[model samples]
Target: MSAETRVVLRRAAASDAAAAADVWLRSFAAALPTVVRPRSDDEVRDHIRDVVVPLRETWVAEVADRGGMGGIVGLMVLDGDLLSQLYLAPEWRGRGIGDRFVALAKRRSPRGLTLWTFQVNKPAHRFYERHGFVAVEFTDGSANEEREPDVRYVWQP
Candidate 1:
């Protein structure tokens, strides 16, 4: 669908876990070619199905269709004051979906918000920066599963 298509952002349901995880996997692959994922595809899917959707504050941005909510174009997971994850379909990037996700995350954690992203993901850095997130800490990746250098960003009102 084009950027003009109607998009709906809402809390994710059990059935949305699969599509939301797919969006994560695809976005990670397309946007992070240099970094290696710590988990296999099946592992990620299982985690999303068994843990993220059921336990985390997960949301999905889907296209609105005549039939109903269309395919999921974006996924977001907010944990308390942490914006744990926000990913969009590769083709769906630049369509303002990510912007909407960030706005929602901010509203969810109006006090403050924190998130992490790999240092190699420059686009992500720019996006978060544009959303008022400041890189407050940098890690050598030792503390993370991927062992890739990362930056910790924080946003406050």
Candidate 2:
């Protein structure tokens, strides 16, 4: 799909867990090649469905295809003021969906929002920076599941 394609962002439903999990896995694989992902695909899928979807305030972005069917292309998860996850399909990156997701998070949490990204994910750093997030802390990879160095970014309105 083109950058101009209309993307509908809404609260994620239980039925959307699978598609959102797919986006999450694909985005992680494409964006964080250097980080070690320890979870098997099935494990990640189950976590998304059982843990993330049920516990987090999640949103999904859906795009209408030419065939008139809508497909989930991206998703964001917020836990309190923490932007825990934001992922878009590989074909949907650089199309302002990420920006929209960040905007939604900011709107929902007017006080502030914070997130962590692997230090090796330079593209994510740039994306977050462009959206007004500033790096507040850096870690030596001990705190996260992947055991990769990470940077924490915060945005305050």
Candidate 3:
């Protein structure tokens, strides 16, 4: 299937919790190998299902493959001015889905937005920078669950 034909972005619903969690688990496993203490699949799944999906403004990207079966492949969670989470399935990276999700967050908070990403996630740092976010702070990894060094990026209109 063409890339354009494969993905759909939408506001996440309660029914999407499981699929969203699946994307979260898969993406986290594939992307965050340097995390000092990564959560188990079950634990991540539970948090996505119970806490993130219900409590955050979440968006999901659904992908339909050649066989026409489709499932959630990406997710973004925004909390107030913070872009708290953004992840895409391994196959979905390099597409513009993440940019679209970030644009949505910017639209929702046009004045400004901020996000924290692990310093080791160079791809994410580049992505945010490409979207006009500037690195504003660097943290020594003490405050996060993974205890990985991190950077904060901010976007202002």
Candidate 4:
């Protein structure tokens, strides 16, 4: 499958902080009910705001028109040789946004990259697989509220 919808990706600014936080919370929380279902929305949002949001520089994906709310449809956080928080909105899944995010992360992180995904998130597993990432380790679970097993993925350029 390919991305039929067009999107624009760019570096995020400090002004995007709050909205980006909301984007991560909304998107991940939505996914939670399905995989490793979180105990509460507040906990999920707390993880986003406290952990994921402040951890990395984020890239935002917006509709090509450049108008409307154009909230962050996708995001990426690169920390040295790691690619963290590479999430695309559910509606944007299966489109090329994720591939683009991965490509950008790889380009920005030529030393190699790694990421952690919920063990049961098959879609993400398959997506990472297609991007040439291999499972490197599996943890019993995150210390975070989800309490789900996590799989680590690594890609070497």
TM, every model: 0.95, 0.95, 0.92, 0.79
Residue pairs in collision within model 2: none
Which regions of candidate 2 deviate over 4 angstroms?
Answer: 1-4
- Of 2 and 3, the candidate ahead on lDDT is 2
Top candidate on lDDT is 1
Clashes of 1: 0
Clashing pairs in 1: none
Candidate 1 at 49: error in angstroms? 0.3
lDDT of 1 by residue, 1-157 (tens): 5555689999999999999999999999999988989899999999999999999999999898765647998999998999999999999999899999999998889999999999999999999999999999999999999999999999999
The CA lDDT of each predicted structure is 0.94, 0.92, 0.89, 0.74
* Runs with alpha carbons beyond 4 Å of true place in candidate 4: 1-5, 34-55, 66-69, 142-145
Error of 4 at 156 (Å): 0.8
Ranking by lDDT: 1, 2, 3, 4
Quote the lDDT for 55 in model 1: 99
